[model samples]
Target: MIKKAVRMKLYPGLKEEYAKRHNQLWPEMKKMLKDHGAKSYSIFFDPETDYLFGYLEIEDEERWAQTANTEINRKWWDFMADVMETNPDNSPVTVDLEQVFEL
Candidate 1:
């Protein structure tokens, strides 16, 4: 398995709203991610900077790319765009983090 991490900037003061949305994540979205080989996923927020750190474990890292083409994924991105720094396609503006150390 591979561990992946990404960083994104969230809109100010929407921490609770972000958590709420994830807590009520759509079933189909969850299933789609799982089916695409994402075994585990999590997002952490940094209050001071409003930065979101996303982490995930996948069986095959390349398989995770397949989720981008799914309709459910597009819908989710569109829904979240207002609360995050996103690109023209409504996808979050994310920077992949390099793994330096792990125990």
Candidate 2:
């Protein structure tokens, strides 16, 4: 399995909404992530900077990218765009993070 992490900026003052949305995430979206070999997905928020950090474990990077192209993922992106920085297609403007150390 490969571990991946990404960073993005969240819209100011939307932390609560962001957390609430994920807390009530759709079932279909969850299933899609699982089907795409995604495991232990998590998101962390930095209150001071409003930066969002996401991490996940995947079996195949290619499959993971393909999974995000699904309708469920698209819908999730659209739903989240209101509280996060997103592109025209509703995808977050993400910065890939390099893994330096893991214990």
Candidate 3:
């Protein structure tokens, strides 16, 4: 498995909404992630800066990229667009993280 991390900015004053949304994430979206090889996915929030951090492990990078092009993924993006920074296509503008250590 390969680990990946990404960061995005949350809209101002939407921390509680953001947390609530994830806490009640859609079942289909969760299933889609797992179907596409995503595991141990998690997101963190920094209220002071409105920054959101996400991490997950995937079995294949190519498959993960392709999965994002599907209808379910598009729907999820649309659902989240109002509260996050997203592109015209509604994908979050992600900053990839480089892993430097593991035990």
Per-model TM values vs. the true structure: 0.98, 0.96, 0.94
Supply every candidate's count of residue pairs whose N, Cα or C atoms clash at under 3 angstroms: 0, 0, 0
Show pairs that collide, candidate 3.
none
lDDT of 3 by residue, 16-91 (tens): 8888888989999889988899978989999788999999989999988887788988998998999999999999
Lowest summed lDDT across 10 adjacent residues in model 3 is found at: 63-72
Task: Kindly list the per-residue Cα lDDT of model 2 for residues 1-103, writing each as its tens digit.
Answer: 8999999999999999999999998999999999999988999999999999999999998999997679999989988888988989999999999999989
Backbone clashes in model 1: 0
Candidate 1 lDDT by residue in tens digits, 1-103: 8899999999999999889999999999999999999989999999999999999999886788989999999999999998999999999999999999989
For model 3, the stretches where C-alpha displacement exceeds 4 angstroms are: none
RMSD of each: 0.6, 0.8, 1.0
The local distance difference test score of model 3 is 0.90
TM-score, candidate number 1: 0.98
Give the best candidate by lDDT. Answer: 1
Greater lDDT among 1 and 3 belongs to 1
